[model samples]
Target: MNAKTETPAIPEGACITAKVPERGTALLGDVVVNPYKLAPLTAIIRDGGQAISAAHVRVLGRGERGVDIAYEVSERSLWTYGGIPVFGLYPDHVNQVEVTYKLDGERIRERYQVYAPAVRLPVVANQTAALPLVEPIKVAPGFEHRLYLFNHLLGEIPGGRAFKWNALGGAAEWDQVGNNWIADSNGDVRWYLDIEQIHDSGRRDGLGGTMGFQQTRDGKLIWGQGQTYSKYDLLGRRVWQRALPDKFADFSHEIRETPNGTYLLRVGTSDYRRPDNKRVRSIRDHIIEVNEAGDVLDFWDLNQILDPYRGELLETLGKAAIQLPEGVQKQESTAANELLEGDLPFGDTPGVGTGRNWAHVNAIDYDASDDSIIISARHQGVVKIGRNKEVKWILASPQGWPERLKAKVLTPVNAKGEALAEEGGLYAEGFDWSWTQHTAWLTGKGTLSVFDNGWGRNFSPTKLAGNYSRAVEYRIDEAKGTVEQLWEYGKERGDEWYSPVTSVVEYRADRDTQFIYSASVGFLTPEKLTTTVLNEVKYGTQDVQVELKVSSRQPGSVGYRALVIDLARAFS
Candidate 1:
């Protein structure tokens, strides 16, 4: 499908009339379902995917602020270019009205009366912000510990200098204590593990950042790289890193862990080669398989699975169209004269997988049960991948990752598929990030929490410059790869602890006490009122207590002292 941007005249509450490619799909096909108001209407197709880009998304409006879309049909897990949620629209099912450019722009339409007959609000809707901290609530308990590392700078030079963001140390698993190890992902390689004082950088010089993990027991751990799954002993010694490279082309995207002690990594580049420079750009999004010793075993690619042909309904391939899913146009044979030594075929440059697809990733997760893998793409929202690098299902985000949630359904539900109100804040348009993902976390109860940073500029309503960030926790209905809404982290409903465009995870389970916990947005240090200002409730509950880490550091100051907040008032 043609992926480019051109302003289309959008009229409110009128028959949708938008730009159309000479041939292919439009942003909105026709009669679409509008879930919020519960009606349907004719909507317009705004900015869609594109032919080429350096970072998957090139901010459209100003600098680095436009909508980023993957025109590939099968991979239509649409989000704001920044991994945030944008509204979704399809033909004959739902009508979508969007206002992505301004802070107040909202393309409000009625709900589809005929579509989704069974979908209804759990209780009457109300606009308010009040969420009570429920039972089993507490920041992650901790001891005197810190593991992992960080990259101080964004490395973008030759030979790739090792860097760190903020590597922390502690028990790796929050659901279990026996599995105590510190781990970190320096926004690069995820290899900083601290297992009972086992430090085996091997002088390889590794960096650290967001997350970390390390096994507690003694044995060779299996973590996959490209083609080869590497093995590492308890002492951080490289036992062996090996994998059959048949599908290990570019496994540098990301990684996750299996409860069985295995590792799940990514392969394939998310960028595309430029026809002008013959240089592949932004080719860095993919999923791979890895083991403890850091060996690459198997791999999968969203490019081969999401059929772009389906998007042809919106528009035909442009002169610079990248490869679409399932529609590989057989290339014509070219003479050696047609080849260039400076082409991407050389070692220094990146590959152009079929010379088509763009840079967009699916779901990313690590399973502790049966060591399975779950990946969703901006194009293909859901995929169940296994250690053998096999795809089991193509699923959708839970409850369609509902951008909008009713206050009543926000309550707890029974196993028979009922809804309850848990909090009150927003009816979100999920994963509408303009640039890329901010955070993706998996809970022990099969919950996938996503921090969708709203940043897209193309799809309308992106220009609004407000604190428009939120966090969402998804309870996966594995039978359909559908993510159901359990909770959201935002200010409207009081779910957010911090308004961080960038945050980290500190998850753990207390083995001795049988407790699961977390503490982020700065360590448990006092003097930094960041945590309390963002998350700690100043209210009172019979069970839950409110606490804060007090510091004399003025609100707008530069540097300040760090100390831990003491136990104070209860809120629950």
Candidate 2:
């Protein structure tokens, strides 16, 4: 027999008296504050009868520097039976929220004064005093209304004795240190994900927090931490969660959604055996394509695709390439008869070392136009591979590469279309290949944009005082096998803008600008500190329209990546 349809029950403790000002609309039944109890500065409005077609919420700012945060509830199902999720409420203040929703093709607007109690922000271990989370160093006029999501590590440095390799018995819990947060133009934290809801407590490995926090085109946030990958709507609602397949051990670096609805995840191989029958574990050198159902469709093992032993740059710079913050003690040789491991002074999560990190692939971007994958390997260079795992092109200095692989490296050319000498072409005038780079992706114009970390610049052993990182774009002529520099930033600022560890460069076609994130700017003078600077630069002129710096009192606080939240996407 067919089961009878049951009426959906109203949410528990929902305010039934909440109604539209004049319409007396009882269709919008209950209003519950923080329905999930996870996102503190949020609320939920249940639909009694009429389904809400759309919703827009705006939280008023307090002062001139405080920029108002607002977004439209993009997910329709969020307002169907569970409740309409409200976001961007100010903590410890009577936040003035302007809510507008459509019911039965009629628009209904209401004003809500939500007083969200202040919450205690997480403190890193060894910190004895309270410190400001993010500071607005510079706010440009036209870019006053923007939000940036910073993916960072908040606890004490990993790879230490207390939080070493598989030790989870550290003094600070993963939940206590927030690894992901969103801040407005005024440097006020508008929203943050309580890592407690996503961190895997049972895991013994130190890698438990989010790594790559990014918003999808549909206005949902997605990230990969350890072995789990999760996607959640802006309302702090988990849409779906998937785990890595058995072959993959841990997820790191990046997770990107393909146009075909599959996900490209950067993961570590469980136990890989070399051609010489040497069994060993590798990290951050594998990429797998998994569907929404958690099925591994295709895999790109960097060990197989690239020469794993190519370490000319790695050996020259050693641990200095990663620029580990000051005060972190370097590890000595262990008594146990184990393989010699390089020092990852800041933490192992940064994924820099000699063994098992040959091709530290920190970023991945797919090109549907030709079914190709572009990756940024810190030890190696920016590489593009085809569906069959064949190297399409290598964009790096032609040094120490095998004769066969060196043939695939692109030749550098000057602006006047003259080919520079291959021996020192990389450091030639107006052209230089990135060293220890981070995020490499194809821009809308089909050109490649990379966050050139500039570590080991020109393969130099000493850290030059003039060393600088830059957001560089290159126009590659595939048929000609040559590359030309298109535009760059941060090089003019010199060492002050050099971020050796993690950063990103994204092209914003909508605004004709580039979003450059300098994730780790270490200052060791008066005190050891790390600052993250974000800039939105104009396309051709290289004018910095927005410059915001995130300062942390905790030394060695490194930011992994930062992305601009496209608020307009929520309404679209």
Question: Local distance difference test, per candidate?
Answer: 0.29, 0.69
Write model 2 residue lDDT over 68-163, tens digit each, in one string: 665556555554326556666666788776666666666666776677767544555555433336766666655666778888765443323333
Task: Give the distance in Å from residue 530's predicted Cα in candidate 1 to where it truly belongs.
Answer: 15
User: lDDT per residue, candidate 1, 361-422, as tens digits?
Assistant: 52367665756666544322334556565554443322212122111112233344454333
Q: Which stretches of candidate 1 lie over 4 Å from their true place?
A: 1-153, 156-247, 269-286, 290-297, 308-359, 368-371, 376-435, 438-441, 457-464, 480-482, 490-507, 511-572
Best by TM-score: 2
Candidate 2 stretches with Cα past 4 Å from truth are 1-28, 48-54, 74-81, 102-107, 119-121, 125-133, 137-142, 155-178, 200-206, 318-355, 422-426, 462-464, 523-528
Worst 10 residues of 2 by lDDT: 1-10
